[model samples]
Structures are given as structure tokens and as C-alpha cells.
Target: MASFPKSPFPKPPFDRQKPQDPPGRDADMDPRPDYGEASYKGSGRLADRKAIITGGDSGIGKAVALAFAREGADVLVSYYDEHEDARETCRLVEEAGRQAIAMPGDIKDPTHCRALAERAAEAFGRIDILVNNAAHQKTFESLEEISDAEWEVTFATNIHAMFYLTKAALPHMRAGASIINTTSVNADTPSPQLLAYATTKGAIQNFTGGLAQILAERDIRVNCVAPGPIWTPLIPSTMPMEKVKNFGAQVPMKRPGQPCELAPVYVMLASPESSYVSGATVAVTGGKPFI
Candidate 1:
């Protein structure tokens, strides 16, 4: 087992780095967010399962993908334009003796989402798990700072794509399959600076709750993971430098969560053990109450 610090970060106040475009590169991150490359050990919980994970390029998505691969699941890593990060995720999956397919495109587009579903069906023969883990976020200090286009794109990338991809993937999903979405603490406690992103996260929680019931009759489980401040590429790319420096200080742990810390919960949600669990939001908030 790999030992971790109290904060899961190298230091309390992380060193400031250059501003990156949306969905920053993990390689360029100062601390290089851990994705359980060395610590994670699997026990065939998801043996032979087929899974599709959006945003599998880095952070939570990458960590989940690694855990799934280690558990003997074939993974299809769907990502945006982050080829380098996506490639590394695929390499990890392959290293675990599982099939890995790197498919890159914009999930904001409905057509691309359908294509992702079709490709997964073609490659994996069927879809056993769909992880709607990709999202786009850019912080705005005030309501006025958020433009009309910005508002629309956040919804498109965060919530709308989840709908489209879930719809497209359902046809291939069988009973006992799982759909795990990545919501956030922002869904419960909206962040004023991330108004648009928070709004979409709320929508996602609603969507997850409703869909869980709708699919329950079919025996298909639906759930979401609500993470607190996590040390992911999304932070530095979207939030201001000051906020980035003090990231996760608000939580009781007074530190951001590492991506690897979230893998076990995802593994439980995807495996057969969660057969009776649906419409549940598992909060990985580093000791912070999710409500």
C-alpha cells in the first residue's frame, strides 16, 4: 500500500503555475496528480467487464480507468483532445492485460457521443459500464463575467453530453450494467465563482436520481460520485491562481483529494456488489459532509 500525506498534496499552498487552456495537461501540473499507477491493487471484482469512461485522460477518470483495468475489465477511454494524457491512460489499461481503446473527440457534440457508444459496442461487443466523468469548467468571479456562450457550453459539456451518451449507450447495456456519473460537492453547495459549472452539476444530480429509478426496473444501476476539491487538471485550468493555490482548504481535511483515493468507491459501484444500490450519490469529500 502507498502511504499518503495528511493533505494528499505536497504542500498546503501549492506553487503557482502558468495558466493552461481548458482541461489542462496532467503532465504540466506542478505536483503531477497521482492516478494510482503504483499503489492500486485489484482483485478481479470487475473481471471481464466492459466499460467506457469519458475524460479518461487524467485525474478521476484516469484513476477509475486504471482501477477497472486492474480488476480485469476491458476499458474504452473516451477523451477530448488530450492525446498525450489519453494515451497514457490506455497504456496503463493495456499494461494490466486488458483491452484499451483510445477514442478522442468532443463529448459536447451529440453525434460524437453516439459515435462513442457505437465504437464501444464494436470494440467491446457490449457496454457493461458507462462512466460520464468528463466535464468543462471555467470560473467567473461574478455573474456578469460569465458570457452567454460560456453558460451554454458548460451545460453542453457537463449535462447534455451525459444525456446523449447515456441514451446512446443504453441500447448496448444489459441488466446488471452500471452508469456512474461524476458530480461534485458543488452540486450540493453551489460555488458562486463557478456558477455555470455548479448549475450543470445540480442538473446532473437530478438526472442521475431520476434515471436511476427509470432504469431500476431494467436492473441497470445508475449512480453518481460527488467529489470535493480534488487535485485534478481541471482545477488549475479553470480556477484563478489564488484559488488554485488554496485548493481544498475549505474542507475539514484542509487539503485536496488525490484522484487515486476515489478509485475504490468507483470499483464498488461498478462491480456486482452494488446490484441493489441505485440512485445513490457517493460523496468522496475528504471528511466534509456532503449535505
Candidate 2:
């Protein structure tokens, strides 16, 4: 019998230093993430397009901003309060030889979300892509530990904000526009400790599909990307320190993914390269099964 082909991927240099934040810290993370600003060559995949990305200040959002800039799009990064992170992301975008604007505000409010869309449009003269990637999650020991405030805030940040921002952006978007939402692997995996947060993520998946069909006639595509455990500031900022150390080990790959590795999917989904793809969820989880 012929032996199965050997896997080609080499062992990743996994660093085991304890991440400082509950969600994780991009600045102090061992083996800093790949930004691809200098190396990723673009054939103008998103040239002349303008993009607005929520939570673009740090983590996966920051990675996507830099990638989009490299792909020839002017990027508007909407962030909450991480000024330093936002500035760093802006610098990377500028380094890509594209324009980047860091707009700081709370996305949970409809007015702020609308303003972001409008301002991005004004600054770039058009809005072609929207990436709803900002999210907040807190660990709970049990279901009862999830308070009403937590539930509301989670939905506000994760789901409601997406709805509000997309609605505001639609008018400015012409045919061939794209909207990308950031869901999570926990949506399908359903962690008991993250019941509320996972619920919002699952809603985002269904929301993406339903909205895609509604916007199909207008030629605006909607989709979601569900990432597995990634080394981002959110891990150190939200999870227990010890759990943060072993965050991605549960995946089949036995290591967490980096934000840079997952950034291309955003570009693919946003660019004309994925013209026929919509109502889809691009799974970037390391070896995790997608349902």
C-alpha cells in the first residue's frame, strides 16, 4: 500500500511567554505578528476603493487595515480608546503607501457608527468596503454569571453595531461594494464560559447570510470571517493569564494563529478576487472544522 503524503507545513516557532492582557498584547507578544506591509505585493486588487474597518486599531483589525492598504485601498480605521494601537496601525498603513485615518469613538452608539461611515466617505470620496470587526467579550464561570449588562453590551458591540454601521454605509456604496463582519470560531464551538459572547457571534453568521441575500440585487456582498484562537490583545485583555498562555493549544494545530496569517481573507473577500463569493463565512481557524 502507498503511504499517505507527508504534510508540508513545518513546525511553527511557538513562544510560551505568558501574555500580559486578558485578551493578549500585540506589543509584547512573543514572535510578533506578520504585517506583510513591505512584502505583500498588490496588483491593485482594491485600487480606488475606500474601506472602513471597526476595531482597526489593534489585533486582527490592525492586520487587516495594513493588508487592505497594501492591496491599494485607502483605509479608515475606527477604534474605541486604544490610541497608541491606532497610531501604530496608521503608521503601518501609511508605510504601505496608502492613506489611513484613525477615528476614535464608541461603535455601540448608532450616531458614532454613522459618523464613521460618513466621515470615511467624505475623506475618501467613496466607501467601497466595510469591515465590522470590533468586539468585546468577558469570561464567565457559569451561565448565571452573565449579567444583563454583559449580554446587552456584547450584542451592542458585536451585532447591533454591525447592523447600524452597514445600514449607514449602504447609501454611500455603489454596486460591487463589500461588507465583512468578524464572527468567531466560538460561534460554532460554543464555549460554556463564553455563552453570551458566542451567542452574538452565531447571530452574526446568520445575519451575514440573510443580509447577503437582501443586498444581492444591489450588488453589495456581505460575508463573515470566523477565526479560531489568534494571538491578539483581546486574549490578554479578556482571558485569565494562564489560559492566555495556552490559548490556541486546543486547536488541532496545537498553536494559536497570528493576526497576519488571517489578514488575507479580508482582502480576498473585499477585493474583486472574490467577486462570486457572498453570504459566506471564510474560516481561518487553524485546522478547526467549520460548521
Candidate 3:
């Protein structure tokens, strides 16, 4: 008999964890998230490619960086101030016998977003894949709890930064280059508690659709991945203890996804194998359908 993917992941209710700020450290989590360190083996799918992955310090971004490296790509890991996490990501990439650079900065700032692109081009000579995977998310009960400043920051970090980074990377990206954005299941099924974050995710899907058409003549592919509940540092740090305990129970799989599980999809998107796939949002929703 074949085993299911969800059989390996831990299920809810998880250990009750206190909520901290966003971009939490994976080291602090009770059950450390997996980034395919033991399981994934690349087959030169992205050989000699040069790529940039934002939020590469932890979560999905880290997994993507590690996978890209194993697939023969040199990666520039762009991240926020998570120096420790960022260093670990670079180490993983280098351990795979690839060049890795950790560039820490605030992606919410347009200037930093531009600088990130410039740094990737400087280190790699050309940009073959651009993964806009860095994001900011906060949960709120109602509109009243969502402050004006918080709302603006969410949009700035989530959507605006993607625009800034993509625009900066365009010149360096040639005809076969790929651009992958990280959207969410919330883009279709808005989580009541994650109002602002969900709204921006919706915007990302629309942006990707329009931009894909705009860049089609250039032959640059643009797409996104909409992941459901995934066990990442951001979860324990952003959600309340009650919510954290029951984090991914709602999904049909009844468990939060491990970052490693989503890495293959990202790997495919960044590879030339996905040349015909653009303007599409691939949903990794743990059995929860999104259309």
C-alpha cells in the first residue's frame, strides 16, 4: 500500500505556543520545521542557474534556496534581520556545493528591494529566477483592530515590494527567466482573522495574472504558489496561542504542511521545464480546493 504525504507531518492540536512578532526563528519552535535536508536530492534541474529568493532566512524561502542549490543553482538569499536564520540558509546552500550570499535588509522598503536585485546581479552576473517569497502577515479579529499604519505596512511588505523587486530584476532577466510569487489559499478563501494579509494575497494573484501577459512578449514567465497552512516560523510567532494550538486542523489533511513538501513545486517553477507554465497559481492546499 502507498502512504500519503500527510502521514509524516504532525497534526493538531499542537503544543500551545505564545505568539511573538512576525518572522519568528525556526530554532525556537517546539517541533522544528523540515527543509528537505535529509530527503531532497536534485538532478541538475536548474544547473548553472542564478536565482534570488527573498525571505530566504526561514520557512518556504529557505527550503527553496536549499533546493535550488542542490539543483546546481547559485542563490542569493535576501532576507530581513534574521541573521541567524539567514546564515543557516546560506550554509545549507554552500553545503550543497553552490555559491550562496545572505543579503539582509527590509523588503518593505523600495530602496532595499532595488538593492536586493542589484546585489543578485552583481553576485551572479545574470538573474535566471526571481522568487518573491518574503512577506509580512498579521491576524486581526475585525477592521477596528486593524490599524491604519499596520494596513499600509502589510500592503507595502507583501505586494508593493514584489513590484519593486520584479521591476529591478527585469533588466537582468533574459528571455527564459522565471518569476515566482508566493500567494496564499487566503487569496481565495479569506481567513477572517487574517484580513489584511488575505487582501494583499488577492492582490498578488491579480498582479501575477496581469504581469504575465505584460511580460509574455519578453518571454519571461510569471506565476505564483498558493500554499495552505504550512508549518513555518511565522505561525507560532504571529498567531495567538489558541490559534497556534489548532493551527492546521481545518485543512482536510488535518496538519500544517512542511516546507520541504512545497519545495518540489517551487523547483519546477524555477526550472526551464516550466517554460510553458505562466500566469497560473499552483495551489498546495493540503486537500483544500481553491479555484
Candidate 4:
């Protein structure tokens, strides 16, 4: 194996800024997150594979798409109307000499989730990897502030969509296939402010564990990724300006992780290199232990 230089991580004391929506744009972020465009040397770990990645428009999802492309996998990026961000991700994947399909729709809808899988199969012949990474989060002072609608929407977008997409994609997945769900540090240490989001993450972790065992006989691997405070557009968009400025201070590293920082872990899970790895929650939390 060859050694590669590490990408630069942003220092503490970030400037306060916010995007207008729940899922923010990468272009709008002040200190743009590193998505391994100029780094992440690939050795064809996922050569000739086909993958579907929800929320592949930006942030952690985009980083994973780029890495998968570089490793020789064709990707289908599913996002929720982030046209520009989705296009940019596709462009990066294409630049890596792989196919990139950008499909814009709401993953919260079970119908749409199934359509995404069908489209991916139609475009790529087979689905080798399925990454349920799209998520929704909002901050509320207390439970009283969280409405029933808000709670339902959170579960619909986060956990339910994962179930829908996985069910749809399983038919296309054969032996040695991989399914990677995006859980969060909140699963182990829930954040009261993000009550709905945290709860869904907890469910996702359990879902991954159960699904892994259920599919073991089929030779399919299932796992999840739990990330801590990654410097993504989601921070400025959903969190308060004050919280955004000090987003990752609680971690021992005292800085939020960059999306690029988590790409390698995703690539490993998607590749044959992790054939023996399953039912595991790989945490990329910048020194924050998931346990």
C-alpha cells in the first residue's frame, strides 16, 4: 500500500452563517468542506460496482460519491431538489472516469424511494451498493416545541425511507452486495435539541444490525456509519447561528469533521475489501467515541 497525505481540517472559531433551508447548499457554506476532490487516491477498491447514494448532492454523501467513483464504481445520486449541488456531485464523479446519475426527488415518499431503485437498476444493470444517507434535522428548545408533524416528517425522511429503499434495492443486490446506512452519534448520545432526528438515528442503528443478520445467509453485508458534527451545509442551515459557530467544540478534537474525512470509511464498506465486515457501526467522529 502507498501512503497519501492528509487533507487539511478547519481550525476552531468558525464564523456564523446560515442557509435558508433544511439541507443547505455546498456553495453557500463559508468554509467549504473538503470532498476529496484534490485528494483521496484510489486503488480501484470498488471497480465495476454500481451504487445508489441518497443525499449524494452534497456534504458526506457527495464525498462518498466522489470516492466511490474514483474507486471505479458507477453511481446514482438521489437528492431532494438540490439541483446545483447534485449536478456538481455528478460532475465530480464523471471526472473520476465513472458514470454518475443525478435523480432529484423526495426520499421521504416510499413511492419515490422505490422509483430511485428501479431507475438505478435500469441505468446500471445491477445494484452492488446501497447507501441510505439522506436525512432531515431541526433544532427545538424542548419537546413541547417539537410538533407531531415535525416528528413524523423526521421519521419518514430518515428511517422509513431507508426501509423503503433497502426493500426495493434488495431484489437487485446479489451475493457480496453491501448496504450502508448513515446513523449518527446521536444514536449513542442523543441530543435533546434534535429529538426527532436523534430518535430516528437510534432506530437506524438497530435497523442496520437486524438487517445484517437477516441477510447474512444471502451473503449480503449490511452496516451503518455514525458521524459526529461534520462540517457540512446541514449545520448552517438547520442549527442556530450561535450553535453553528461552535458546532463541534464538544468533541475532543474541538473541531467539526470535514465530509472528505469520512469518505474512506464509506468506500471501504462499499468494497469487496470489507467482505468480512458487516453489522458494524463505523464511527467517524473526530475522536468522539460512539460507544
Q: Is candidate 2 or candidate 4 better by lDDT?
A: 4
Per-residue lDDT for 149-252 in model 2, tens only? 98999999999999999999988999999999999988788888788889999999999999999999999999999999887778766776668667777878
Tell me the deviation in Å of residue 158 in model 4. Answer: 0.3
Instruction: TM-score for candidate 4, please give it.
Output: 0.97
Worst 10 residues of 2 by lDDT: 6-15
Q: Residue by residue across 1-291, what tens digits does model 1's lDDT show?
A: 999655435545998977898799898788889899999999999999999999999989999999999999999999989999999999999999999999999999999999999999999899999999999999888889889999999999999999999999999999999999999999999989889999999999999999999999999999999999999999999888998998988888888899999999999999999899899999999799988
Candidate 3 residues 89-160, lDDT tens each?
Answer: 999999999999999888888899889889989989999999999889888888999999999999999999
Q: Give the clashing pairs for model 4.
A: none
TM-score of each: 0.97, 0.91, 0.97, 0.97
Give me the runs in candidate 4 sitting further than 4 Å from their true place: 1-7
Cα misplacement distance, residue 147 of candidate 2 (Å): 1.6
**Please, what are the lDDT tens digits per residue for candidate 4 over residues 1-291?**
999875368766787675568798878777889999998888999999999999999999999999999999999999999999999999999999999999999888889989999999999999999999999999999899999999999999999999999999999999999999999999999999999999999999999999999999999999999999999888899998889888888898888999989999999898898999999999988898779
Clashes of each: 0, 16, 0, 0
